[model samples]
Target: MPLKKLTYLLLTCLFASLLTGAPAYGQRTKKTRAQLENEKKRNLEKIAETKKALENAQAQKEVTVGNIKAIKEQISSQEEQINLMEQDIDLIDMEMQDIVSAKEGLETKLQQLQKEYAAMLYSASKNSGKLNKLSFLFSASSFNELFMRYKYLQQYTENRKAQVIQMNKVAALLRERQSNLEGKRSDKKRILSAKVVETKNLEDLKTRQTAMVGELSKKETDLRTEIEASKRSVTRLDNLIANIVAREISRKNKERERLQDQEAKIAKNRPTKQPAKKSENLDGAETALGRSFGASRARLPWPVQRGFISDRFGVKEHPVLHGVLINNNGIDIQTPSNATVRAVYDGTVKDISEIPGLGKVVTIQHGEYFTVYANINQVFASVGQKIAAKETIGTAGVSSGATEINFQIWHNTERLNPESWLVPR
Candidate 1:
């Protein structure tokens, strides 16, 4: 092939090779942007919910433990929002850097193309004075040489035109990249402004929380009494669920024994198998239901439509009382007054009872797993009724000057953290 054709082919292959590496990088950046946006959306939603809950608590005109908890949650979400903004700024910076680098590369390419085109023009002009195009071709020794000369001139002119077009394209692309870089910078500036506002809001929430805690600390004696009453309520609910679950296990065991006896009478001479394990002896349907419920870990819907956990599971020191620890059997969700409570998963209503200081309670059983919803004001489902996921069971009742509910999950007699079971907000 001619030198000009070979050079064109080599340049085309080089451009193609450069283009082939773009999609994977683009896909990765797209995924990162999507994830960041999703996280920010979730953070904002939590902030909104916490704001509503705080508004409801403030409307009561009394600073209670629930109010302080809501403020703390608000502060947490606000800080998270600010962090997300920082992440956005960081991502934009990275994008701008890439654009700057690409713009520089395009500028360099355009310069090279212009330089080459100028050199080609100078060479053609110098040769033009020596022999005009028609004379140059006709002066060849034979018709074949003349034809070859004509083809060379044609390719040489085309190469210069191609260089000029390429330079124009690179310049246009550089302009577009500059525009994109400016856009990213503008985005970073906007997010930084929002972040400043969020930081201020977070500081305000923390100040309010400190004031509430200081006020609560003044009522240490009353707070202690209330804490004791709440513990009693938790103990009562725990016993209720334990007794009910025990009875359920006994019933299943009796039914299994009855079947075994009937089988024994039918096949007297048959060899007896070893006693089945406790889990194996349980009803097959119950076992399957337990498996399904277990499989749904971290995917179950919230019992209430909107709320944040005011109190987490396990034992922790009280926020106001010095050296005082509160043992929580379940997570406490702070929601709006009379907010409807729904079942997190499909189960049968095992028990519903009212206890002192805790309002009404409803317990649902999913095979060996049991979920208890307490602090309910009104119960809608009856005992032994089958309930589906997100089915309304009752409405939350007010406590601690704010509306809230205690939600728990248990496997047989062992308590499981509701936070681990429920999906992230």
Candidate 2:
């Protein structure tokens, strides 16, 4: 009966450790929430921007109706974000459920551990009585036998005490797990609310995109010099983002190295056991790249103030060449004959130069993100200079094939669709 109880005790411990061994996920989930919230905040900012852009988009009253399949992509992206958020909420729900279930089971586990500990202690105490003690030395007939029996009894006593201590420790752990479980349940509730909010916002985005398509369908689009100018701006922005992200990667590597060393040292004190598999590493280089680009989203400001979007974002039939379609990463905001372009956000100026066909351009780096305001007649900012939000950086000029301000967003050399970010005008 005692052996059966001990086997059950060992099995219970093994099961509990397996269930609880995952490194704390709460902090990682919090970071994910922060990133997603940042994305949502940026997305909402885009809503305000698109509203503003839609107001000015009215300038080009002419609209040409054709296939509008591209707007579907924007809608899809928004839906995807919403879907991902929903999945996150679902995962949180499951995790919390497990924690809660574990907690509910903990009271029984604690009672069992305590009872087993007491039983072990009581059994050891019984063996410690003088009558039992006498058997250790007296049961042996030879001197050598006596010493061996005594040593065996001493080891047996220590083993029993150790079992009691281990059981007591496990009981305390069960209580701690119970507290953590309750806290996780509360957190899951909040995430559920956030998921609902994101879902509604996604549906709203689709309606707005539909409206944009309807308004733009009347105009015949043209992309002459605009192509070259937009390309130059995008390249510059890409360079800036790459540089900034590279620096960030370097910094993160240093930090990881420091922490890993500490983890290695701490590992020595921990008992050998199977550790839980970690979820996706959001801190990895690939994930960071996504963050650097997609994370920038809609917080960025417009380059030209008081301009009509003479051209919308995406692929269009070349204005002059009817058979040819030109792919555009962004839109053209046509201002008065001479409009001074400004920095969209606080950042370090990375480039200030003129390209042959693109005219003047200025690029700025903001942490791991970058922005370019190009197709300028005059450049005012210098490389390596720190610039603030809305600071006048240059004067608009003819670049690529259009006389309009060309803007682009980049993160670590990857170009993100500025159409998703910039105010739609």
Measured by TM-score, the strongest candidate is 1
Clashes of each: 0, 16
Superposition error at 114 for model 2 (Å):
5.3
Segments in model 2 whose C-alpha atoms lie over 4 Å from true places: 1-81, 97-122, 125-150, 201-374, 381-404, 407-425
Cα displacement (angstroms), candidate 2, residue 297, comes to: 18
Candidate 2, residues 7-71: lDDT per residue as tens digits? 45684565466356532455446777677667766654444444443343335343222112223
Cα-lDDT of candidate 2: 0.60
| TM-scores of the candidates in the order shown | 0.89, 0.44
Candidate topping lDDT? 1
Task: Flag regions of model 1 displaced more than 4 Å.
Answer: 21-26, 132-161, 268-282
Q: Which ten-residue region of model 2 has the weakest summed lDDT? A: 62-71
Displacement of the residue 55 alpha carbon in candidate 1, Å: 1.8
- lDDT (Cα, 0-100) at 383 in candidate 1: 94
